[model samples]
Target: MSLEKIKTVTLADVSINNKGEYGIGASAVDYSDELYTYLRITDINDDGTLNKNDLKSVDDVDAKNYLLNENDVVFARTGNSTGKAYYYDKMDGELVYAGFLIKFSLDSSKINPKFMKYYVLSKDYKGWVNSMCTGSTRPNINAKMYGNMELILPPREQQDFLVNILGEIDNKIEINKMINKNLEKTLITIFNSWFINFENYDNSKGMKIDDSYGEIPVDWSVEMLEDYVDFVTGVEPGSKNYHEKPEPNDIPFLRVGDLGSRDNGVFIDPSLSKNKILKYDDIVLSLDATIGIVKMGLEGAYSTGMRKLVIKNDNINQPFLYCLVKSNRIQRIIETFATGTTILHAGKSIKHMNFVLSDKKTMDDFGKIGNPIISIILTNLKEIEYLTNLRDTLLPKLMSGEIDVSEVNCDLELKYNYMKYLFNQIHTPMSKSVV
Candidate 1:
């Protein structure tokens, strides 16, 4: 690593224009297969990745004018999301960025534009954003201001090397993410048939009964959710205690928005928390705004907006509880409990909710089948978090030329093999066919 190899340049120096182009001022229509996907500021995650769960489309005739290309990087210019970005990936399909975003098309001849995307995710660049936007009520970075933002970049050859390495890590993360997505979907389906609907197993066809919830196997009964599970709300260790970098004794502070990934952009001292520390594959649900987002990952302290469903009774079956929390019936009920204007908060609605329990043998059998699938999903999630942390750790060092990754083997086939081996490690015979 050499200081001479690094150069200082304004964002505009590597971009097409001094001021980046504004996006379409159009509302999101219901998703249209024929129309371009409408990307709002809300669509960009804290890590500079696009949120794919609620993808909508723009039906405007001028939607094509706002279309993003592979070379373009869009920035969120206003409010709490100021400086947030989303790099257009073709895999996301053709996208039309909203007006709140500023599109910066890289001048490929100057430097690799993708470098800036990773740079934005770096602590240095984020620090600059904080410095620039300090003391603003409604923080906003207009297009010209974004263009004026400076970048300290590595030499062109070094830029390419860093890009390839970082890109490989990201691609691997995406692969693991997709694997977990499919795994969760499969697990939920299996849970529904085996426990919820009682349709898949031989014992499922046994005597049935219609009750408060619905029709269920005769041996299955509904119990108050609170009776079997201790609903533990998370601890909030003050904003002053929150730090971005992971130091000793610090764990990720899982917020409502952080249910998707382990990296919530901040960490807090776990010792500060008197509440229950999360375990791997723990059933957790968002009890606040954007309610009912159930996910299992991250052994960390969580925010007040979340609830960890700790099973006090061993007979309840953890996997069954997981599937029950993820089910549509539970989701709808949780949503109904949420109340607020901008930020909805769910009360102790678990008291009002019912947990359907099957016969001990049936519950045990379902756990046997479902636990492995949950384990696979959890494995992939942990891997995704591991890879993401690896990439994030390497990003700043690589960008600042403190470390050189030029000799790294980042070839496509090698990356593919590495990902294959990771997936191959924990996969069961059932997981093989389910996937």
Candidate 2:
């Protein structure tokens, strides 16, 4: 039969999203910037981005066979994680899938790679997963099942058209993320130089002196962390109060899993935890399973496993405080506060933590440098949130044919152009600011 005559296709068809292989069953090692990232089911979020919180890597002599390329998609094959899918983007760098994941090489000529990934994440696909994964002891689907799954095919040109539209939005989001990552690295570099190494001290102001933590500029004094900041403990509010689709009064209730920009995961009714409300620029740290992941740039209510550091005033530079918690020194100390082998808890013990109170002038100097870098990171995060919301709103509509590809009047183009404008406005100044 002629391909043009077909209105539906199985994913297993080699000319489509095929070339299936089960992932390498190797155990994960620590994540290294230099090594290929290990993509496990746990490493993918529901919306199909890498879970940045606990990403690990693998180093093996047979690594070449496991390496993934662009146009590849992976499926989470077992347990409750079934039906989750992630497609490799060149932006994500090199990755190798772990066991419990299934990989497919997507052929763009037959199907849009991004489209296929989105399809698997669709309500239709989820309904299918719910139905197919039932009656089994646990939800499990193999490569053969994935191959047999069907797609109501659209013409190649239409698929391309849809991919072009949606892909641009995702591409912009990724570019912003990459920009933010570079900006953060810049913050760390300056932080290490000015604070840790004392490399940038103007000798006219002060000289290095021995402190409990190696050497610091003469005028700096160490103080209890509680003096400059107050740690606000979050409440459980219970799983019954959780809301994935937040109503008007519901705020994102953060968990350890949400260390990624303090994100769009579970929301909670704010009335349940009114006093625990968090806002932008608030610093939150995870103390349980993951340990010592500090992040800002979110608005929500936090869970008990996390702590929101309340700044008393400008005495502790906010950006300085942020980088401080992320520092290896503070991080090590924070880990010691935890008491469990399986799930650690820093909890109320944060009160016992000591803080290095840099001299006022140095903090001000560092803040001037660090603030903009952090501001850029925070701004990029906000923009990412916005772009994600836009894509999410459009996705189901687009996938279900509610919004046609010939959407000449689609506001997505207008909004997308604005996103690009924001991107262009951001990159140059941020790059120049880092030095």
Best by lDDT: 1
Off by over 4 Å in 2: 1-6, 14-19, 27-38, 51-63, 91-94, 203-211, 261-264, 405-435
- Please list the Cα RMSD from the true structure of every candidate, rounded to 1 decimal place: 5.7, 6.0
Q: Write the per-residue lDDT of candidate 2 for residues 36-109, one digit (tens) a residue.
A: 78888888877787777678989887766898887788888999778888888766778889889988887876
Candidate 1 residue-wise lDDT, 100-136, digit = tens = 9999998889988789879889988889889878999
TM-score of each: 0.87, 0.84
Model 1 local distance difference test score: 0.77
Query: What does candidate 1 score on TM?
Result: 0.87
